[model samples]
Structure formats: structure tokens, C-alpha cells
Target: MALDIYPAIDLKEGRAVRLFKGDMQSATIYGEALEFAKMFEDMGAKWLHIVDLDGAFAGIPQNLKCIEEILRTTHLQIQIGGGIRDEERIKLYVDMGVSRIILGSIATKNWEFVKTMARSYPVAVGIDARNGKVATQGWAKESDMYSGALAEKFVGSAVQAIICTDINRDGALSGINISFTQDIASRSGIYTIASGGFASSGELKILDENPYISGVIIGKAFYEGKINLKEAFALFEK
Candidate 1:
């Protein structure tokens, strides 16, 4: 199967940034968010993964204007998450031309609501895990629920995908937690996208060989020039 690539553009205070281990204080601004969206589009990316970092921490959509600008300007299919806690906000993003909306913190608190939304829209559950435990409220609060256990809840639902991130490896550029990601994929029985700590084409090849992993979110590695977006995309082309 051809592995899908989602070039990421995490927004912080209206600027594109990368955070270390989901730390708000460790944000390294890349540039204007819109520019990064365009750059990803130029690199032959079919999808763009965007996160409202400010919104994730605030529990409210804070970077509406920035998000709107990218939606209006870029043609890449967008999947966005962060601070989307209500049906109204979900509707708002859908109306704004977003292809999909990811529910992070809310998935841990009210997965039933997530299942309901999945019936009507393209919804993906963002399971950001730290040490096998699920973390919510922007990775600040660790829940007692195990990551695989949470994923098992949506075993047979309308939910489109499970975006599982290993908090410890995120933004560190060490390596991707393939075993952890595969575990989620096995439990959820849903399309799973791996996020965090993707540093090279080697990792991409590893994911391509796994049938359960549908895609990956490229963050710090892409920003730090550790991976070439075009070259990574070319791997599955052969």
C-alpha cells in the first residue's frame, strides 16, 4: 500500500511552530503558518496535518484567523485538531473547508460524542500518549486510561482514524515508536496515523511495510531538515 504523508504545520499564537514533548514553552517558530502550508502543497503532499497549539491548551479555538487563511489559500486536503470541543466548533471548521477535524482531549473525556460526530463527518481521534498512558488537556494531564485501552473503545465505530503520538519521542528527533503505533493500530482496528519523532526515510520505510499504519505526521524532522519531504514521498512510488 502507498503510505500517506501528512506534512504538519502546528500553529502557536498564529505562527508555525514545533514543540518539544508537547511543551508550550519549548515552541520554535518556523514562520507564518500559511507559508508552510503552501510549501507542503508544493512538495507533492496530498494532505496537510494542522494543529492549533494555542487552542489545544486553551480549550477554545484561538487561532481562527490563521486557520481560515490557510484553508482559503491552500488546496491541500486539511485535517486539523485542537480546542475543538463542541459541535458548533466542529461545524465551523467543516464550513471553513477543512477536510477533517481531529478530537484530542475530548476523545478521552467523551468518546461517545466522538462516535456520534464520526457518523456525520470525517472525525479522527487524537490519542497522544505518554509512557503507555493517555494524556489530555494538551498533554498536561495524564489520565489513568491506558493508550491501547482507549483505542479499543473505537474498535467498531464510524471514526475515520486514530492519530497516536508518543509524547516522549515527539520533537526529539530520536526515532518513531513503531511498536507503540502498531499496537494502537491493532487495538483500534481503525486506520491509524503515527505522529511524533519521525526523523528519516528509514522510519517512513518501516511504516510502509506495516499494513495497519495508514499514514504519519512529519513535524520536527521536516523542520530540522532531517527528512526530505519529496524524497520520502518518492519511496512508496517505486
Candidate 2:
């Protein structure tokens, strides 16, 4: 049950912005994407979670400029999500040396596309939900699908992991939705990455014991100076 914490570098309008509940309009740019990524790397984080905010909302590929900058700069294992809907987009990221390509919107909408991607790439499935119902189209829309039901779709494939994010808790700095996250992992045997509403290391300490939980992605807490990545790494090192 080793826990891996991925400091998030979410790019919105080519700058780093941690959005509340995945809201794009209510965001504040904090720094350049490359500099931010470097800071996370400096903290001894071996993996980076990078998201293209615009690409996620527009349903089109954006932020390749910043992504390329990250690829050129860091040797860390990079897992990229957002606007990755088709085979070409998946190929583009893999060709650029992205370690894992996350399929979100397309995985919920097009079964054939998801199947094709699992067959062709090192892909991951992201289930972003609000109150247990899945959301898509950049978290602007919700669906009737439960997170567990969705995980059943990737039973056997190249789907390396499932990133389950509680949309209501994202960027809120309230608390990690542990019960919901743990429930999904318990029911589904796939490796799970917890996302959204992680406000402190104490919350992570609780999660560290869960063998089903493979990783957690930190965004607002990391930006707000709540969770110290360096200390987190040190704690895990011990």
C-alpha cells in the first residue's frame, strides 16, 4: 500500500491555475508552467500530473507548447490528462514521451474509442464525479454512471490505472473524500489514484494505509501551502 503523491501542474491559459470544482472561470494564474513543474521536481517528486485546462474544456488539444516544455525540461515520469480523446492525440503525447495518457471524456462517451486506445497506448481512465455521478466535457456535465460501474469497463486492457476525482471537493481545500475514494477502490480491483480536496498531509497519512489506493494527486493544497511535498517525500522515505 505504498502511496505516491503527484504534485499537480494544471495549465490554464498557458499558466498554472488551480480551479475550484473544476471551474475554469474562477481561476487565478500563479506561475509559468515550466517553473512550476521544476519546483515540484525539486521537491523530489518522481511523477508529475499535468493537465491542459483549456484542452479539457474545449474538447480540442491545447497546451502542447507547455507540455513540450515540460518534456524537454524534466526526466520525471509524466502522466498527462485532458483533451486526449482519440488515437492521434494519444499518439502525439506518447511520441512526445508522455509516460501515461489519461482518457476521460472519450472513455465515457465512445466505447469503441476507449477500446481502441487501450489496445494501442499506455492509457489510464479518469472518472471525475460529483456526488457519485460521473462528469464529462471538462466537468461541465454530469452522467448517471457510478464510478464503480465505469471501472468495470476497463477490467482487462492497457488501462494502467483509474484516477477517481470527486468534483465537488476539487480545489475546495475542504478535505479529501476518503470514503468515496476508498469505496470505489474496494469495489474495483484496478489501481486507483485519488484526486481532489486533499488539504493536508494528515489526510494522506490515513490514505497511506489503504493498499487499494495507489496514488493521490495534489493541486490546491500544494498551491495554498498546506501540504509540503518535500516533507511528504521525507515521510514516505522513512
- The number of the candidate with the highest lDDT is 1
> What is the number of residue pairs that collide in model 1?
0
Model 1 spans > 4 angstroms off? none
The residue-by-residue lDDT of candidate 2 on 100-198, one tens digit each, is 988998878875678677777888888899988889988998888877778777776567888999999999988878877877777657788999999
Best by TM-score: 1
Pairs that collide in candidate 2 are: none
Which ten contiguous residues of candidate 2 have the minimum total lDDT?
Answer: 150-159
Which pairs clash inside model 1?
none
Backbone clashes, candidate 2: 0
Worst ten in a row by lDDT for model 1: 229-238
TM-score, one value per model: 0.97, 0.95
